[model samples]
Target: MSLLLGVASLSACAQSPAPERANGGKGTTPATSADAPAVEAGTPDARALAAIRTINEEIKVDRIAAAPLPGFREVVVGGQVLYVSDDGRYLVQGTLYDVKDKKDLSQVGLSVVRRELLDTVPTKDRIIFAPPSPKYTVAVFTDVGCSYCRKLHQEIAEYNKQGIAVEYLAFPRMGVASEDFKKMEAVWCSQDRRKALTDAKNDRKVVAKQCKNPVRMQYEIGQRAGLTGTPMIITESGVQMPGYMPPEALRAALDKLAAEGEAGPGAAVAGGH
Candidate 1:
């Protein structure tokens, strides 16, 4: 039996691009039609071709393989995990649940990808709010004009107090060369990036300046990650949670995730964008 998992949308507080849906349920879904071949163990290059057919400038396909559950092939495209039938015709988008193991297997694959990609972002490109003894850290894709992003920044101290370090990655809602993008550049180029980020988030004036900044690179990264909203959170363990979260609630979620990481692997695969 194949199960269809439901994907929820964030409020106006956050939005995403045209990425496929993800399933998170107790039952595993079938990727292939009844007439198609069953899934077999394989690599991304082999399995990815089966589904996407061709990889070009667009339709980024990361990897593909037999899912943890039988009968389904796992495909990662546009930074999201989707499943395809062995024939590559049938496609399923949702978090895959391995009921036998009582685990969310889809998250396991995504978290791995997020961690690897996030590691590529340099510290010089980010504005960090860190605590001396941080229990956990979250990287946020933020826009100066985003209200939810502002709300999150307003509680920066509270989050720091909870041992949750917040790293600000410039993700102007507007695409490059727009006013929002320029404003972000000003903040990054400021003498004190931390203060400039705070001021900008608070609607204070940002002295216009120019310098090589990662504002564009961060936006591109966000796009690849299917980031369509502000205040998008990526935990240290690579669990992505979208939209605004109050400090206490954020802390609890981070704490629970950190504890689960200690359990290792599948235990930390529940959260994704």
Candidate 2:
């Protein structure tokens, strides 16, 4: 079922939009007039870009295109795919359904982008907890002060016992300058990091420690990856599971995702808060 849906989603992306030419040029050409701004290849015009920029200044518009229905531009905002009208009058936040195949094509596109963005964070910078024998590896962006994050930490052994290697990256949740950030830095800088993380997550104050750390960089990476909260999990295949999931549920999800070979948005099951 999912395989057919995946194929259809891929097809939709392939057929999205072609570059528009101005002044009868073979390719997109710059124009001085407001009505005839240069349209980038496979993207919308300057007018649409400006309109989208006005709505959400933070949204990094990668590409813009007219939707299947006219007057709307499918805007790829950072790694979170969304759609906006060409006139910037309306914005759609949910996934677009491909009725024929019962697939969420919008989610498929976002998953591809999310995976690419996750790869930008260097693996060497993370604090890894590897199982002696691993079956799955998941990268997690976590805040030291988040309750749900602490819960996930409590199950570290269970996850490892199930052959899932948990790699931790600092998310902070609070800005880099906050107390939570400092605590995370302490944990990362400790003589024994794994122990420090356990101690901190268990509500113990880690002895003040400092060193050159990648906490800030990890936070920035999370921002660029559209992570607004703590405990965001990313599987080896680039599937994102936001928030926390119980050990048993997480193991089952990992198994299913492994079997499927791909996961779209909302395919992940959440653990308790």
Candidate 3:
């Protein structure tokens, strides 16, 4: 579900409020003061950019472009989608629906964006389970101790045998401050990360060690990609299959995804942090 709600109002294009009357109720002048010169759309565009700049600087807006709907524009902030108005006078925090398409357009946009984002991440940064030769690769956001995560791990051989390569990205499940996050750090920092990850999932000891790693960054990526639970699977094209599936069933899903091409080229739009 989308997190943005309600319309935000701004004073950018609206006429100035009428001054309070001496009598104290309120007064109204002509809605459009005849003397007001035609609004300089060029200058207002600059003002609109400046208005968007006022959003929390740390939020990291990567791209902003006109939305499918008139009077609104789409902005990619922290890899999530949002809509703002043309004159920067209103903001809508929700997904846009295409009544004719019968699909969630926001999810469509995000899937393409997610695939592009992951394409930039090198394989060395993720733990990969693969067969000698593989036909498909899937990315999963996992927590070491999550029950379903363990179940998926135990069936890794089954997946690989089916020509499904599983690449793991960390998601601590608990916030970064928790022990699980520390453990995740240890696993990533280990000289043999693949072995360490397997051991941790098998209920064995993970050698406690620390070093610079992408564990935290991966978790943040998962958050931005709309992950709400462990074992969230993402296919090569960024189709999110949330939850666990038996090896055969998962292969079937992957085959189905392979048969269908991308959602659409128009879905691919995003900016980086």
Candidate 4:
């Protein structure tokens, strides 16, 4: 169930074919133009599968369903959504917009996938800071080394006061081998995770410890979910609000979404800080 796709690199390959191993450096023969005709001779699904394999043989096809775009099939590779032509000759990566309805069809589709993925992480695996009776819950992908992540953590009390529960998921942008990952591991291993995380956010020295922890698993999950930055906030409804939002502003935005009865891609609100 690993969804860590290097789509960005794949997109780059589409423009200029990589000179390295055709099998993505896995020592296997890469698919070429000659392979296309044979793949096309098979079923559309087979052809689509072959086409994506040509891009990255390691790509895991999670789901394949009808796309919002006609004559295209939506393929969920890992957690990233891709639109493939019915003929399986074409592949699209990026936002698929519905101009008439003013919606991002790709994100709308991704929201569902995200929710499903997040649901797999049990409550015990998360580091939650919540009110006695929370009104809204947001899963925040955070890195302790990230400044904005620290800023957000500094206001954990405020967020809780606003009746918005913050459930933290580790996302060490520096990778698992980095010091930040070890720091997070120590935090999770601590007897009091909330206190440890707060102390780490404040740049306090945390006694390093190791134990069975979800830091690495959560980091991989974030990778699968196509997370590009820290402080990425995802609502219970799976709408992503990237960047940091102040306590009051965040509560207001949540209220606005609730009032409007919407939590789609269009409902996503961005904040500079």
Clashes of each: 6, 1, 1, 2
User: What overall lDDT goes with each candidate model?
Assistant: 0.67, 0.62, 0.64, 0.69
Off by over 4 Å in 1: 1-12, 15-47, 54-57, 98-103, 262-268
Clashing pairs in 2: 245-271
- Top candidate by lDDT: 4
Better of 1 and 2 by lDDT: 1
Compare candidates 1 and 3 on lDDT and give the better one. Answer: 1
lDDT of 4 by residue, 153-205 (tens): 88999999999999998776676556887899899899998889888888898
Cα error, candidate 3, residue 196 (Å): 1.5
Relative to the unseen true structure, what is the Cα RMSD of model 1?
A: 8.8
Candidate 3 Cα misplacement greater than 4 A, ranges: 1-55, 263-273
TM-score, every prediction: 0.78, 0.70, 0.72, 0.79
Off by over 4 Å in 2: 1-48, 56-58, 62-73, 85-90, 98-102, 263-273
User: Per-residue lDDT tens digits of candidate 3, residues 1-273?
Assistant: 334222212201111122111121121121211212233455543344445556653343444555677877666554466777777876666667777855556555566656755665669989999998888888988888887889989999999999888999877777666677789889998989899999988878998887777776676566556565677777776676647777898888766655554322223322110
lDDT of 3 at 135: 80
| Sliding window of 10 residues with minimal summed lDDT for model 2 | 1-10
